[model samples]
Target chain A: MSNQKLFHVAVVGATGAVGEQIIRLLETRDFPIEKLTLLSSERSAGTKLTFKGNDITVKAATPDSFKGVDIALFSAGGGVSLELIPHAISHGAVCIDNTSAYRMDPDTPLVVPEVNIDRINEHKGVIANPNCSTIQMVAALKPLYDRYGISRIIVSTYQAVSGAGSRAIDEMLRQSKEILAGNTVEPQILPVGALPVKHQIAFNAIPQIDKFTENGFTYEEMKMINETKKILGDDSLEVTATCVRIPVVYGHSESVYVEMKQDFDLEEVKQLLADAPGIVLQDNPAEQQYPLAADAAGKLETFVGRVRRDLSNPRGLNMWIVSDNLLKGAAWNAVQIAEYIAIEQK
Target chain B: MSNQKLFHVAVVGATGAVGEQIIRLLETRDFPIEKLTLLSSERSAGTKLTFKGNDITVKAATPDSFKGVDIALFSAGGGVSLELIPHAISHGAVCIDNTSAYRMDPDTPLVVPEVNIDRINEHKGVIANPNCSTIQMVAALKPLYDRYGISRIIVSTYQAVSGAGSRAIDEMLRQSKEILAGNTVEPQILPVGALPVKHQIAFNAIPQIDKFTENGFTYEEMKMINETKKILGDDSLEVTATCVRIPVVYGHSESVYVEMKQDFDLEEVKQLLADAPGIVLQDNPAEQQYPLAADAAGKLETFVGRVRRDLSNPRGLNMWIVSDNLLKGAAWNAVQIAEYIAIEQK
Candidate 1:
């Protein structure tokens, strides 16, 4: 602790799609890093990456690997998180898990920093990053919820293929070329990669983002529905999600419908969102301006646009939210949670 | 009919995205034709188009140009249809308008053949083509509405930019290349062209499509909300629409949350969708296969997947609906209705 300043950050799943973005974001945001340890599965171990001119070799991630880490950020699959998070906690590492493994765990704190920074202090060594689609949504909704007291939420997501993983992104590129060349291409990863059914995502929309749970909601949909309630800290809030995957490589966009507890004006609602943390107001209708994935692809801001009242429900508002699924949705979200932990422990 | 003979159809929007495909569909379906008359805006007029080994010259569309034309199919634009439709209808011809200008006119029949083919007979002069987003949705819901009365429909569309026009498709391609090359590109011609706002659609999602109306709904969203109610002939059915423009070029996918008058069994709903005309079932979760835009891009079928009952609401069902926006949503729908008009009148 003598002159060895700043936090020692360990990034698991370092070679993954979101993991790579997390690396870039860390560099761009100038996250405090005393020692950066990169880790991945055994198959991906030994990969070399240069971060801030330091070549860091990816080590095989084992439970014991987290020994001296101060903060562990994870974008690995839920399986990896379920296995390694305890290792992280045991080694005194505050784990920010960017997977569904502990998102709904009653014992764990699911967080979007701008919305629920206070909740991070209650974390018992583990903080859950929400579904990529859910993160941007809650980031945008928190300000509205704080001011308007949202009674219910209904969101339909336009997600990208990269959220499925690196292989899915590759498959999208491969199939897109094949379709352009007028060649027959087999779909490998999409909707869910491990599922027996495959689908083309090069120039199309896929209505399902994750595997369906027995309760009839796809795991992705449930993540948004449950995470919204958790992040917003309103368990009684009525939330529903219909998640769909589009061909974009990054950014998860959502059409979020909300019912407020009190009457409000559209101008006031826009003002609240504009002032909200992590939110960028792109809602000037006269200019035909709003958020789009292409614009939000590399950015960290959650874009909100097309704010208006619901015709059927006067108290309800509908908005379009778009953010880079890899950044704001996954990697950046995990990093922010880690930062939140740091800020709170201070 | 004078000679008791049908005229060959020349699709003017040919060689263009919708035009090229309409040509292929017309040939595949074997639409009755004795001679084809291809017409386009002056910029594209006089271009030689090949159809079934026949070279057709695309003449400039004019009000005096519909002479002897029995059926004129249009998907060019509102201006083209507005200028040429009266001429077509006045000269013993039927015009199928695939534009916004005539859709809300009380006299025009907004026809989705599967849903309201009979309405074609009531056309005073022209038949209106519904929005690409509206067409597939109403087609899928029609069968359900027929089997069990629908009470409400809350649809959030993940639409492709190809619906905005050829220039938008070009812009998406242009913007993607620029982003991949690490260049910042500005957006133009999305949400609404007339509005001051234009956004990058390359890797983004824009919630505002079309202009805002008096009630806060964009023209695109209002089209879906209004058109759905009108097509279903049920003013009482609650409909809320949030239309978004994504980077996709061909398909318009929807995350439709529907409330029915009766509770439905999962298997029974599958059977109904299977039996429904023009609808394809792709909802096998075990295989991870479902309807996707890339797969639906070149195909002329509406796909339904992720069929599941809402856990909390007994009457609510959440499903994914996807189809090529160019085909079932716009161009092909117009052509199909035109074919039906040719046949049913005989």
Candidate 2:
């Protein structure tokens, strides 16, 4: 450990939810960091956060903030990533972005470490982390994709409010208390905070996650659809998603139906998932054990359960996948990539 | 209205959630009833409920309770319905059972009035109401099924706790309050109340809605799969469902993917749904309008939205369906069947 090469790392959006988790993971995982820089928006600047028993003050991120930084992790937002990534790259720092800004860019390899870590070398300067909903799904299904080729995926997400950010989580808790007190709720944030219409997320399900795209699907749904194909390196893969926001604070649970090209044994499929990297299989019908969002919260591993063959399609499979949207979905995924880059440099 | 013939009506499980809704519907719809008899389990018997301006006491249901019942609506548990329905029928009462007791019985007809009202006449003695999750979905898709001939369906449900009975609803409310207060919750009623293993329903998603069946599917999932085929009268049609329980109170939301036998024009599909008997189309993406479970609560009509064409399969269509589980999913569906039987007898 003493002889390992150390590097300077900068965490953009350091005070945000995912950013805070990233900082904690870096400290707990004992990453080879010689120095750390924290960056956020001007509103969140000057916030002091503890890292490895040392206090680091967050500064407003700008084009010049990446100077002498060997690696930069960006999770502020798509707009901030789009603006600052080029500057970070120009300073000879590799940027691992946790935003949608560069994920669809052909040169920026959309990498889920467990699924396609080799693709990390193909990145010119930026390695894109897939959407939170897509990360847990691809990680859980990578083994199945290797054994029996996947043709199509139809997913319906029960996403947490934290995926929309911290304010949405606060709104859900507040609205819940208000409803319990028999008071009428005036929802100010939910479904899409940017959108004018706000639906109650307390004791209800909102089918929209991000703003609606031109095709009737939300941006969140398209991210899962497009990013899954890219991360798996399957241009011909058929992926469709219905992303919904439930009142949960942390974990995102997905109901996925995948049609495989080859017939596979159900027991062997379960075995493969149980043995997969970064996946925990909790499927046991007799004991009533299955992956649940409340249990998956704060966990780094993607949990897979409810594995069964579709009665309609002989080669089709159905499974429930759950993971903390902030951890495995966003922060942990980016850190996993960062760890790979750290080892590669050594 | 005065010329219509009146009949003696009996409500089994009158103290239950769906049974209470049935009583309200019978009063509000002004069904031609000369008398209303409310029946419940011995535990809930003698509870006084109001109907029109009068107070009626619920009685413990026995075989003799249905002696003069012209039409009986049953919303009790499956075991109670199985034991009492035959007695009701022997007393010359036409029974509409909301339990799963007779839904798949060869001699009984499973009716979703808008989809298959004609089959109600073929009932030997009891007409079975489809499961709550299945009811809203088929009601929304019936028009599309008729126009384009659906060949297959894949559905994932976001169901409310009330479908489990009033106790499950109370558990969710209690758990939510506990969670908001930052106290640990001891869940005793969700996922399945009878199952030994309990899961927290407060701000979480439970993939298992009922006890696991032999096929690795919950009974609720099986109900959706089998009941759809029975109601649509299509043995060749393929349907698969993954039923989940979220922390909602009254409405159930379904994300459905259906493949039509014929190629469909998207606009025509929307129009067909808008013109359907008991469905409301709430799909205007530009204005951020869509059906939400919060808005669908207490409504008799099923709300359909997020309608789009599948990018992979040209004939495939995707939709979101929501409805009050106690109304269109149960009580009202039974009442619709009862109305038909009453007119037939007259």
Q: Which candidate is the best by TM-score?
A: 2
lDDT, candidate 1, A1-346, per-residue tens: 3343477889999999978988887887777687889999999999999899889999999988887899999888889999999889989999988888998999998888788777777889888888888888888888778887988787888788888888887887777667555688887777676776676776667667777787767888888877788888788888888887777777777888888999988899999989988899987666556777867878878989878887877897888888988888888888777665555554
Going through the candidates in the order shown, the clash numbers are 24, 0
How big is the positional error of residue A183 in model 1, measured in Å on the Cα after superposition? 4.4
Q: Deviation in angstroms for A333 in model 2?
A: 0.5
User: What is the CAPRI rating of model 1's predicted complex?
Assistant: medium
Off by over 4 Å in 1: A1-6, A20-35, A47-53, A177-184, B1-26, B170-198, B211-216
Show the lowest summed lDDT stretch of 10 residues, model 1 chain B: B3-12
CAPRI quality band, candidate 2: high
What is candidate 2's CA lDDT for residue A55?
A: 93
lDDT of each: 0.81, 0.93
